[model samples]
Target: MTDLARDGTHPGAPPPGVTMSAPDVDTHCPYCALQCGMTLRATPQRVEVRSRQFPTNRGGLCQKGWTAAELLDHPDRLTTPLVRDPHTAQLRPATWDEALDRVARTITGLQTAYGPDSIAVFGGGGLTNEKAYALGKFARVTLRTRNIDYNGRFCMSSAAAAGNRAFGIDRGLPFPLADLAGADTLLLVGANVAETMPPLVRYLVEQKARGGNLIVIDPRVTATARQATLHLQPMPGTDLAVANALLHIAVTEGWVDKDYVETRTAGFDAVRRSVAGYWPAQVERLSGVPVADLETAARALGTAGTAIILTARGAEQHAKGVDTVTAFINLALALGLPGRPGSGYGCLTGQGNGQGGREHGQKADQLPGYRRIDDPAARAHVAGVWGVHPDDLPGPGLSAYELLDSIGSPTGPRALLVFGSNPVVSAPRAGRIQRRLGDLDLLVVADFVLSETAAMADVVLPTAQWAEEDGTMTNLEGRVLRRRALRPPPAGVRTDLSVIAELARRLVGDGMAGNGTTGGRTTGSATDGSGTTGGGAGSSFPEDPRLVFDELRRASAGGIADYAGVTWDRIDAEDGVFWPCPAEDRPGTPRLFAETFPTPDGRARFLPVEHRPAAEEVCPEYPLYLTTGRVLAQYQSGAQTRRIGPLRTAAPNAFLELHPDLASRLGVADGDEVTVHSRRGEMRAPARLSDTIRADTVFAPFHWGGAARANSLTNDALDPTSKMPEFKVCAVRVERA
Candidate 1:
């Protein structure tokens, strides 16, 4: 790493675009969880994004982050609400009053006909923490529906499930991401940081500069793989076997940290018995990693003074995702990795607010402050803040996939309100989910663009983007960073907070339960949750984000992912406030599990897990494995990134990446048209021959839609615990189109 990489500038170099001295607002990127620091300037022509000093990226920006300003005034950006005409059945421009009133009337009608559960809410990981918090409250208090969940369920639910059972808590990294800079060894199970997060590569380089080893394990030779000291190309859906085998070798080689296991962890004996059969030769035969490479990887990780293990979607998007993550955590534990400074297991969260999104009421099973909804104590505490009885709050709802699958069924909601997500392009078995969404009695989508999902919505409400809003977002490190609005939203666009508040007002302002009231603060009354009348909050639905945060702080005062002390002023003074800060005077916790574990016994647990075949395995009919991932130039579902000119030009179309041997066997040449068929559906794209992938597998980016939609062929088999659909690997066969 050079001094320039550290300082983000040279002696006399010019800044990103506009002068930093004239920066109108300082905030983070609008893309991934890196939340790279940036300064927005009001250039003569448009809003300019210039690199600014911050910890996550050190002022470095990827192409997607650099070109983000283009979306501020994109020609396709929606500036008015669109409502489906009752007679023509076509979306047409409408006033905000008409659109919101129609949605509110539909909501009342559906609930009156089918009950409160007739309405469901879907959120996204891209929303600010304030939005996430308010959305959850809206679903529970105003709508009184038990069916609320978010897209983060697809991103890190597996890792989160594993983390909770083992460590008794789940914070994406549990430590600052910068800690990787001083690590002796880094084992990236399935993450490709070089492309997904370019700025994070600097930490890997620094570790290598210190004579440390960087090991990468994946089916394809990704750009991150090219930078590794050693690359272990395992079979698709077999990384768990590799992890178990490595731990087996560590035990045989006497590399186990017996002292740490004896005192800091539990259930070692069960794990020891579980992994006894995962010998080197067996794993080599099962995973195709070869015994020698496994041995070397085991040695590098086990012998290191301080080593870390990380997992991503490739390893956590399977039916056995939680168990697979547990396998790696088991290895990290056996090596005495976690709870010791830079050496531990962490998940590299994908979305911009993935870490915080799951914490505050967006997920099906959680409430504000990362408290479980089913827990009576948690329910009572949060209900108090909202001025409602604990019994009045709805119970846990269905997870993301199940909610979508049940869309029009007898057990599912008849109406769905979507916020900041595009499941029609991102969901597994998307072709089917698309039809389910179509069956809804009323479908409302809030976004800045007409995404594939929004295109099918009965009502589309244009909402504000990141640069046009002031709120907070928690990055991968659990640090709560402030997002200052560079400018107000365009003329016809409004913030999601405003939309939610207005709808709540329409539903409850007349002292009518959204489902029709019996009067006297019974149903969705005019009261704010507590028995207060018109004075305290003015309206139960407060549109200002700051007011919502004040409520969030009070509600989360004693909860696990505590944000009681994390004020906006505090966030501005410090780089950002880490969570578990219970009071204004107490410093936030940057590194969890540094002293005592948060479990009942004050120790981490060793949960034993085994390798299992993918939900859909290859067969004679479907002889090849298919995996999905993100491309460097495009983000998830390409809702925003694909709209940008430069990004669209960089990755203009989706392509089927196949090994030369496979392409030759199938009689397909580079740029030739090819179609891939799976049990769910099929997708077609131009053939892209690349020896970087395994001969038995094919790859495609899931950022495009229509015939190129890779998700159309993905399996929907879900993890039992997390309900996460297996989006990574499925059985498929290919032929020239």
Candidate 2:
């Protein structure tokens, strides 16, 4: 197949540049994982975005991507450092010198009093690969602390955990998105790509045009589901049963790929027995999907020449998320989908860099290149690149929620450094997390905007925005593309790398020598005995993106997501490059496990999983299941997207979406005020009545904070294997306000 056909870029003629003289800089959008390619024409006044043909989103731009430039000149953008007054409890402008010195002193004092682990670092998946790497390195080497994790643990941790257990690696999408176009059938579970990533719906449209069938399993008839050939609306948190029942039908009808299963997989007997109990009738009773529809969906998958199974947060943000994904995988294995062209299972990553964030040491239990932190060999390899002894490196620390939960505890970290995430509006039980932030001795937030989380920080550092920075971001398809700086950042703002380096110098002294060595001590020769670069006690960390990427390459040499062969120059020349490119001249592996699986015996494992009830079940008191998701106009947390005038106008605030029956029962109208109360907290929003959702379920977007924060009612119950909170399903009572 041609590259254009295989990569899923433009299927027609390319468009001309908006400005031919200046040659607009080609870059990807700063929104979802599709990272839709776009060209920016920069002028003294503003930047204009135009679609650029690329693999993921082709030449289309979503509403968020089209309005992303508004954030560059947002009125509330943080242009200088701010330090909160101890007595007044109000943040006031402060000089960089004053803010840095005070933050350093507070962190040092905290470490001295409560030990190294007392200082924690929290990062975000929106950060570039280089920033994520630098943040992890700064946490482990400079602070010498084990308390470090990123927001990705809340995004797709369950999918990652399940993928690793089943495939020996997790790269979001093993095959290119283009492969979906050739599949005979597609079974999408809990993903509303038509609304979340609008450009991707073209593939589904194409599939339908070609007479291919589409099966969508979700609690709500989402926009994406409206286009499906068969939409199976299951009860919330019953996805595992739907998947198990499908496999049961396939096995009972003698539609299994017996030869492929025996030759390419192991542990099938256990899975077969596990799924035998989930017959169509039983699944229909538990999942609320009719037996006729379940049979039709199963037959479509079982008989298709090639099919694809894709899932997203809806099926993964539950107490049994790993098992839910595992059940889906078991169905794919039974049908011999994986390792086949135009077929296999993949997770649709939500965040822009969610696929790369966890692969590069930002996760609590991981190192760069998807290596486990507890593995001795992995530690030695990463430590050697960082110029530190393996023994000096800290072991696995707390996961994202665990770290957040420990913020104000007696034995918790006394200080926290947050970069790029607004957890105040995004975290499960957000109201509690906000209160926890209030109790911290020191909270430092580095972001371009004064987000809800930054507003509560003791010190807020102004950082460079996406268009003003040069780095690389890995999209959902495992393709790493370069993001070039089109213009200079605001005068007072600094890049995240610069902020991280400055903090490292102040906290660890001469260890700022970008070589990654700490020298096992914290002392320097500058003011307050802390060294400055250029003329002080030690060398400075390289602020250049290329230099930092060189170190990242070295650190990831032998790991699963190896990028040693990929470089900025190569990315610029080739549009993008896929990972596991271990050698300079070697072509990247586009579709993995074509010949053999990555497991020990070169065979895929069929994990046995069973359906489980939601962690927080609906009862008489709170007799409705509440699920949370995103809206088309707003992105995560609404930190940046809300600042855009048109987007804000499009989606002003959060609302409760319920079936007409439920709305009638509650005596609420479309625009009537309603109060939703859960065990943890209550939130109020306008009720939006619809028949697309199950009568026993309600829906809300989790993008807004304050009284509209959906996460305030989300459960923090952890998935045993993934540690992912149950953000998709919770119990709540709705009343007219």
Candidate 3:
């Protein structure tokens, strides 16, 4: 493990106005996807944070990063493990042994009575790389259950699935973050990084500095749009129309890159002919973007020296999300941006560990190193890495929503273990998911705080937060960095790794016994001690985190990641390095796609596109459209950031965004509480009038929950390919309270 700060204290520790010495600690922001590199200072009592050198943020940080210390010892922080008495809803402080034993007994009881499939594990993208890796292994090897998934199903699973299908691999940026600094044009669809990851806005700012044009397409004009050169307000669920229009212009006007198309793409003719009917006027009628603006956007994209098209959940969180992303990728291919410098298709991942979680196969249908669970070769590879025979591995598992819906059903998984996720506040169809959780036989939740999800658990395991843990985290651009602990873990709290180990020991027993999955286990499972189940009778297993990374390096043997030469020694001496580090002498790859595609034929696929209406459409009774997104101060579901002082002060509560005309018609004022309803459920929050929203549209932050959860009204209908919910836009009605 890396050493603690020389001064012996946590970073961001000073009082609101006090000055302190910088602790010789370097780390990344523990909050959002921007992953701004920071220098943390610590004294005996407090920690202070300042911006440091990093490619993504480049010596810049948002308010959340600056106030990291507020959460270290917050009032609501859970300092001890707790267990709820089944008879009464009271939570009593319990020892770690009691909590772990309770979880073990409950899980064992469920498995014994209902079968191994009855138990499930749910992880989160907010977890550190180490924690995520451990959690995934713990589920598959110790629990021996295929019903493992995470909240990423609600975030970027759609984008990841689309990218893998089109590009043959799933790298969010196949390029570096700095590449955007030189682009002459940028087309952003459904992203509001300005409010979510403020440090990243600098790249757009730099683009504007060089006369680069900004084209923003969204149903609502967001904070990022205020700086845009052009904003194309589209109708809900109609982004495919605008995307097809751009492709049509590129094909008809002869702007298509014939060389790249012929050399590196398949299914071009089909896509070309498909877009012929999507003319500007037709697209304008379908989307709300005017014909003139569509033409201008197409021209700007086609004619710019270098154009980058970036997309996020807003475009990917729909029933037709996969098709929409495929269409956008086709447009990028037609514009010849994927393989060139200063131009490419990039996705800004929403969570701090979203990219890494996917890379390590924390999803329902994937394996480590982004290998498919069903593919023979991928299964062989992961099984070999996991020390299990390919045939011994289970088949593809259900997505998060499906898993939640399946609970307590005859065909459903009945037990669940959650780590660092609050689905009651974050998942779509919150009411249904909560009821489903109630139907489960057993529920164990591990988190730093008593999150909404944990509130329903039969046993709650208190775990360390970012400041109280030591691990690595991968940012949006796939940059891996170390997250060192500055403070000791709370009195009765434990690291997720320790808790997972304790549970694994309880389930699998001592290394002396042989289990087919874990080989001859010394501690964890056989799969190289990284908690993977091997082919042999479960043998030797290592419980240490560093050894786990060693096995991960071994598993990525011939691939882009080789960590044989890397050690905590080297990491501490030289700071953190990017992955795909083939050798000790060579530096890690910062950008991908410089040479060739990773596909079998070395060509990218131009997946066909078709538009589908949202699962729920606005009716006369509910005539206004509702969109969900992040607010400036709150992170996903507000588990930790909500406790941060400065951020909480800035946005203490959730408020609905409405157009003045709509608000006036509804007889609602700025502070008036209004109930927003859909077929699924409803929530009441104060309404704020803003001209930025369309007259018939309203907006709300997805972070609000509990009695006022946003997901209660969100449609849980998922994209057919990715199984991601439509959290972006849906039909809803608003009324004055």
If both were scored by TM-score, which would come out higher, candidate 1 or candidate 3? 1
Q: Give the Cα lDDT of each candidate.
A: 0.88, 0.85, 0.76
| Candidates sorted on TM-score, descending | 1, 2, 3
lDDT of 1 by residue, 1-737 (tens): 22322224331233245344466799999999989888888766888877777887887777777778889999999999999998999999999999999998888888877888999999999999889999998888888888999999999999999999999888999889889988899999889887788778888888999999999999999888888999999989998899999999999999999999999999999999889999999999999999999999999999999999999999999999999999999999899988898888899999999989999998999999989999999987777677666777889999999999999799798999999999999999999999999999999999999999999999999999999999999999999999999889999999999999888887776433346642113333333343543221114567788987877887777888999999999999999999989999999998988777888998889988888899889999999999999877799999899898867876898999999999889999999999999999999999999999999999999999999999999999999999989998999999999
Evaluated against the true structure, the overall lDDT of model 2 is 0.85
lDDT winner between candidates 1 and 3: 1
Count: clashes, candidate 1 = 5
List the candidates' TM-scores in order: 0.96, 0.94, 0.93
Task: Provide the lDDT at 152 for model 2.
Answer: 92
Clashes of 3: 23
Better of 1 and 2 by TM-score: 1
lDDT of 3 by residue, 339-408 (tens): 7888999888988888777666567777665656788976666566665566656667899999988997
Worst 10 residues of 1 by lDDT: 3-12
- The sequence of per-residue lDDT tens digits that candidate 2 reaches over residues 1-737 is 01212122232322222232244888888999999988888777778777777887777766677777778988898899999998998999998989988888887777767878888899999999998988887777777788999899999999998988888889888999999888899999999987788788878888988899999988988878888999999999999999999999999998889998999999999999988999899888898999999999999999999999999999999989999998998899899998899999999999999988888888899889888999999987776566566676789999999999998888898889999899999999989988888888999999988899999999999999989999999999899988878787998899999988787777657332222344333222212111211112112356888888877887788789999899998898887889989977998888987988878888888999988799999999999999999887789999998888867876888999999988888889899999999998989999999899999999999999889889999999999999999999999999999
RMSD of each: 3.1, 5.1, 4.9
Candidate closest to the true structure, highest lDDT: 1
Cα deviation in Å at residue 665, candidate 2? 1.1
Q: What global local distance difference test value does model 3 have?
A: 0.76
Model 1: lDDT equals 0.88
Residue pairs that clash (backbone atoms under 3 angstroms), model 1 = 386-529, 387-529, 387-530, 388-529, 513-524
